[model samples]
Target chain A: MRNPRTGWLLLSPTLIILLIFGFAPFLYVLFVGFNQWNVFSADDGLVFNGLDNFRRLVFDDDFLHSVGLTARFAIFAIGSEIILGFVLAQMLTRNFPGKSLFRIIHTLPLMVAPIAVGAIWRLLVIPGFGPVPFFLDRWFDLKYQIGSYPDQALWTSVIMDVWHWTPFVTLTMLAGLSAIPKEPVEQAKVDGASRFQVFWYVTLPFLRPVLLTTVFIRIMDAIRTVDEVWMLAGGGPGTRFTGIYIWRVVFPRTDYGYGSSISLITLYLTIVLCWLLFIAISGRRKGEVE
Target chain B: MKKRFTFILVIAIALLANMSLVSADMHGWWAEAAAPYAGATIRGVSESTPPSNYVADVLAAQFTELTGINVEFETTSWDQMYSKAINDMEANTGIYDFVYIEQDIIYSYLAQDYLVNLTQFAADNPDLAYEGYDESAFTSFADYFKNADGDLFGVPMEAFVKVYLYRKDLFEDADIMAAFEEEYGYPLAPAENFDQYRDNAMFFTAYGENMDMDLWGTTVQGSTGHPASTYEFLESIGPSFGLYNWGINLDAGSAMSANGGALDGDTAVEALTFWLSMLPFAPPEATSSTWDEVASSFAAGRAAQGWVYGENAAWIATDESRSAVTGNVGVRLPVTAPGVIEAAEMGDGYIGYYDGGAFGVPHSSRNKEATLLWLQFIGQSSVQAEWAAAGARITHTATFDDPLIAEQDAKVDGYYTLLEEQGPLFAGAPPFPFHAQVREVIDPFIQRAILGELSPADALSQAAAAVDEELSRLGYGM
Candidate 1:
């Protein structure tokens, strides 16, 4: 659309900003990952320790446990979100009374900040004062205490994530659903095909790309979740996901070297995961073309 | 007789006039010293505790008004405050003129040379030294902020012990007393030993259950994932069982008894087990409670007894709007195991944590001269009484005798009296430069124990091993 030099000049500012804020820190963290640097002990500057931090990470039990916890969280949270989001999106595709109001109400949770969401859920589940516990105790004689029960605390965080993020999935899927052509469904109906058959053969194939994209995004986000969980349970008991584990190390412990090493490992693992999903999506598209 | 009365009156009048002149001279000194930096805006950061809030809202404004200097004090959560201050100092960003240094972390700061020696600073700049400011006016707690050479690095702002608080009304109730005595074969009183404390906890818990009340026996600061839980075990509960200095032998660089430390010794295991045993008697919220929540739980009348920080004692005993057991709150020293109190008296150990903080001028500060004035202003005897009343923390020895504190002493069931007389028994955290690092490694094990993921014996054993490994890695005792 323009001369090459003009385009390069116009993009220089954004490229420079990206280099300064994004690429520079990434390179610094990578460098730090190979060194022994405790902020309190950093007056002597970074001590080059080669792969020592990475070597230690291999045997770090707490970090390993946090990785497992994050994996579990991602699977449960993203799984429930996708299924629930698809169902909601399907329902919204149909004409209904107060549909606009329902959409607005449903999307409100997505608008709340992650930190606020965590605070809100914490208030909802706090013992004695929280209505969730009060009602559970009154109706079912159940003692719903997140502070004591690790399993309950973990599940509560999953539920909180679901509540906060399902709206995004629903809206994205709804857009995909709306953009689907009507002719195939009409032809399927004309052919005396059942609703399940039409959905499987016509509607689902068209929605596959959107579903893949949504799941990919959710997986990336859920794996890195810290704020809401930190706010809700404060990385307490069952809620010390990988992100919170890294935060505890870097900030509270001030173990910059180990924290950097763990962060890089997590980043690499995340990239590998997205690559696999990307391969799956690309492969599926090629198969469809055939 | 008239001549004698006239002579006495003349003497009194002259003394009063001299006092006013001295006060005026002090204010004049502040103005003259601050004249160089009159228009400069000095920034500081502290945790949003009552004392720090007083410094921000009241003292800052007063200092500014007196000297025409602008002060911007940011009071935030404890974690944020520490992270911000440490980051600024480490980076030499000069973002903060002064920072609150908790008694526990002052050693770390001193080791890093992150703070200005206020004593030396004042001595070098004699013109800026306030005549009214005296370091001796502070309680012995001020000694915690001194470096190896006995040079002052921080001005003590707040100091209080973790005291045992119980429900006076319930203890005094005839029926409750009879029931407790019938069950325990002793008169119900503030516990004097570990066994008595446990018996009281059990009896009170059962009594509350039987009476269909919302009371528990005690509050436990046992949040499984927070540092508060570690502090409860190490600083508060462990010392009561005669395990001191976090059971770590700093000289030997070990936490294992075999290596000359008592971290995993029998007493530490017993301490942890005894503390965990109270969980059944603690309210459902105990597992989630930190120091703040423990205070709130006691104030709400949900716990009949608890080891509460003294900073909360005044409010829990007097603030009816926030406290349900205001008039019935009682304060005492925590029950210690046999020989523990003796050890504390001999200075071989401590009974519990003496928690407080002080303001220090960071070495990275751009306005050290101006900040010194603010620190001294708060350190003065005239400001101590009101600040102590507002914050339930007394750093100045004279504050306990002030009329305001005397009135507060009655309302808080002589909490100030206990602090003044018994504060020496409750020591601050050990002077470990690796305090945060060691705590982080050991905290998970303690959390595991709290959640029943590990037995008390196993938790302490593993924690001891972890601490030893960490200390060795840090080249301690090498």
Candidate 2:
């Protein structure tokens, strides 16, 4: 019924690019997931092993441990990022002097590359040589090496993630806060609602969609955390995050088949988790409407 | 007038002819062989070590001048180099004409047929070999790059032995020695055995504490989450305790004791325990220290001793700007448990780790002939002395007697002499095609042990079991 030729012409470039870069690679991954492929094996030419690789995943303790670490990292990092971002957004939304400058300065961390962030933090936290250790000793007398000790390495990485990404969440929330209807706040005040009550009922409900979106984006991004952790802690001291674990399997180990399976598993889980979150949020909104 | 004019003209003609012949002689056989491939661009990738940097900066320019083939040699990190090279080879992409193959990965490269056999290539194309390329001049380290049939695959570029280095200033201090003797009932000196090593570590650590100095007894390559920590445990500490070949029982081809493998055997567990014991004596950064950090720590005078790579020895010993303890560093064979040498000699173990890398033409190379000429050009004996001096890694037997190396031996406190005399006691990693797989399974366990999440015995036991399971899955144990 529509002009199909013009529509196809308009979408061809993007579709082709996506097919070449994104879809093709995903299809290849799916294909390889069912085959036994080793990059270094001369004898085997992508031998089809069906579900063997997937079965192997069931008993892979290292992989399971990495999943646990990744989950913990996500909960702590994303949770902190959201709370700090909301607070900063609330503060910045008020009319104030040099508000633009403060906003710009807060976004500076977002401009730097994640790997550079990791490297800078590495320098800051090095024992005996770094300024951080010197000040900590002078003030707190705590002799903690942030990226070395098993107990501290993962948390240090989490703090770094928060520092890098909290600005993004703040920016998103700020946009949402600006678009909020002003009448609700006046009505709340006229009804003698306390500041906390107004915020809980009016501000939070209006910001729910934005908060859900930010959380989803962050959770997905957090699952793909590699560059900073690789540069700083190297997924070490028993903090082997899942992303680096898959990378080690694929590249270092050259077990392409198994790596592809793990990749698919990660992709499947991400999709399912995101879908569940979306459905739950939708259901809550429906209940509120009712 | 006619006779004088004729004589002057003939002399001028003769001089010009002689200059042309001299230029041709200097160009050498490689120039003639590469004449057809002139102006062709070839690419390579290698780790950004001093030696590789020298090759990229100095040798590539020289080779381009001599052979007329332009070489764009990328000096990159170890991870990127391996990834790019392997990807190119796997995909049959003619991106890299040549690749650096470390001793540890040569087995995987050969097993995969990713590399062209240099011996066969030479035999097939005698015209491509450089005039000065004598294979016999290469040291035994080159054997690591050869196949079971005694055919060469990669051209050895840099070879060195991992060695023990101590701060002479701390060992000879009278007060420290007296304290050590009173406490441990032995004179404080460069360690002779594991026991002495441990005692010295404990004493120096305590001594530093008493002096209120920010010092540690030793530096550990114990980045608990990196492959470097695993390498330190497997190569440096494991060999000294008589756990050879990564404690893998090759007789049964499994790492599990149930399959007769010794990966978690008594000797390996003991070695792992001893290695972890040094963690407390090591600087606080031990769990984050890689080879580079370890070298930096030793050079900064944060540690009394370290198992330093030979590549860093010359710079650490002579570069005053980098090394705070310049001229006070002493190099020796690592202190080993008793019977390690004998066990190595009797063909059951090794004393230390021999580490190096070589350049090989890949099968995917579009310009194999030109790349071959380039490899042979660097492998020439004439260039060995300069490269060895700059990189502090020698791969030729004749280089041991080179005047430049002799000069550096004195500068590095006889590091060259020790390597020349005791290099044979060391061995490269076993020829396992699944090297990265096995190491990945074990590396985390080592980090776990370092973090005290698992005891040494438990870590090794779990690691051995995991390795066995992996091996069986990969069709080894079956």
Candidate 3:
């Protein structure tokens, strides 16, 4: 009876915050999703078109194209962040001359703000005159660089995203890495196990839960990112992705119900991907426990 | 556990504090606070035109000096201005006292009953209406503003016609211009007809070697992924072809369909084909040029002539500014089509232009009283004359017709002559009730044709088919 009272007392603040900012909007989104309402006419009540919005998306070529682009972009961008993030986190775990400074530097991108990262990269990649392009051309004679073509622009946007966010993954992985018990590692070392063998067998298995969790979180975030891509390319060199595709629907042309349908599809995609990752994590953890 | 609860409590308080800080003052327009002397405070909005800045900052200062009323100006881009006006008016947001709208928005805005009828305002103040303002103050084409019942919603500011500009020095060369004039049987002024313009541009571009000039004859805006550039090209060529005549005339609609052609697959194909065929004569990379690029090309001395809006004049007058051929350029009317049938032989023989911006009110403004004051002040003969005199504003007839403005402003003479003689060439029409839908159908066709993704004929036909589908969905009678 005392624990129940304490639980209620402890959870009230969080529940209230989530209720107002999170649940309220989430509930309103249902009404918005069902109607032909727009930012201009949000007040003029719902048109009650039922599943008509979703029905249109089935035949919409732009929707299909955006879905494909998001999958491809997320796979490549998230893959890079995780691999690089894991390596950096591992390096930080070891003692080095400037380990403290390196740890501080790792957190710098996270602290600088996402908009600033986008602005900095946008200037460097501006096609003809930007110094980055100038220097690349001077060295390699690769005149047409990443800023001009749609696919190249997508990759450049991804690289800038990775630059800003890989650090967050590194910080999480560092905590996960440090949390591992020392006894198993000590035993492996005494038993003459090599560093690579010991890491693969002992350390990797132990940290699999945290790494999977971090990767799952990053995947969800990568799908929703609009601002960085918005600032970097303005979704151009012509839009080849979901974030920009959704923006075009919401703004420029105020096709509200259709845009809401696209957002709903994005939410579903996020849940399905993260759920799959969770299953894999559970299976791996269960194997280790056995 | 106690410490964690304390931390969470502090975070909740902090979040609430932050939210309060970021919230905007959402009280609908405060008429009393906005206006101290007048019965209501007037809040006006205009697009970020250079003249609007002058009016808001410099001229507003003068207006305030003359009449002590606190007025505030809200400004944004032309696109933003129209979208906001359409939204604010439709929703009755009451955030603005006066809104500067464009012709496109005016069509839709008038369809609704938000605008305060100008009849009462004009009747109450006769000197403010036609009595003080003369025909000279306005372009000849001011009749469009009259509603079906012969009522005015907004006042005309200026007659905007497409002024075909070229490098005078480049045209002055005898050897090059002699051949052009002899072939065309007129001065090598800008093309007066669409066919003549195309042929003349082709000749100039091909003989670039003989002319000893590495210049193309014409450039057009293609870069921006919208229908505005297409609309410019369409308006310039449509009258020549007789596609439309001042809105869809039900009596003449059949003739328009047969003679000029319908907005069907074939017509769409023909439209795209014509514009794409002229692509080579544009800048090498004109595939990426918008209206800004066209002006920049002219300013950089890269092209002989091009299509651009009138605001470029402000850019040109600043000699140390971005324009390369600042003082050397002159303006004229766009070219029309070649004579085909005996009757078609006459062609339209005129150019085309669309309106920049106009004003409208929303149904839901909290500050309707204050907004009415600004609307009246903006429509006043004295304010119009003053704005025109500054050389920065296009005049509504009430303002431009004032003899005081004509005497005061030098830039008004050249522009006035253009408006008087050629302003009737350009007229305003609604694109479609559902304009967003129209762009959805129109943009891909233009984009594809310019990118060489499809032949002009194929691209246009498909685009027309798409637009028709959208129109059918909207239940349009036409």
Best by TM-score: 1
User: DockQ for each of the predicted structures, in order?
Assistant: 0.54, 0.57, 0.08
Kindly give the stretch of ten consecutive residues in candidate 2 chain B with the minimal lDDT sum: B469-478
What are the TM values for chain B, all candidates?
A: 0.95, 0.92, 0.73
- lDDT per model vs. reference: 0.90, 0.86, 0.61
Tell me the spans in candidate 1 whose CA falls farther than 4 Å from its real position.
A41-44, B1-26
Give lDDT tens digits, candidate 2, residues B136-178: 8899899998889888889999888889999998888887789
Q: Which stretches of candidate 2 lie over 4 Å from their true place?
A: A40-43, B1-24, B28-32, B346-348
The i-RMS of every model, in angstroms, reads: 2.2, 2.3, 5.5
Report the C-alpha lDDT of model 3 over B1-478, residue by residue, as the tens digit. 9999999999999998876653322111222223344533456677775556655776555435434555677766544565566556655777676677555555545655567666555556443343333433443344454467766666554335555777776777787688877776776766666576677677677667465555776876664333455565455545445444322233322112332325433443454566667767875435545455566666776667766565564354333467667556766655544442222323333335545554555556665544444554455455665455443346564444567645533432255455544555565654334555455456665566666776866655565556555444443424
Compose the digit string of candidate 2's lDDT tens values, residues A1-290. 38999899999999999999999999999999999887554444789999999998878888898888888999999999999999999999897999999899999999999889988988887776778878988899988785456557788889889999999999999998998999999899999999999988889889989988998999899987888888877777545788988988898778899999999998888788888988898788788779
TM-score of each: 0.96, 0.93, 0.75
Candidate 1 residue-wise lDDT at B465? 95
Model 2 residue B192 lDDT? 89
User: Residue B339, candidate 1: how far off, in angstroms?
Assistant: 1.0
Which docking category, incorrect, acceptable, medium or high, applies to candidate 3?
A: incorrect
Give lDDT: candidate 3, residue A247: 65
Q: Report the Cα lDDT for residue B365, model 2.
A: 96
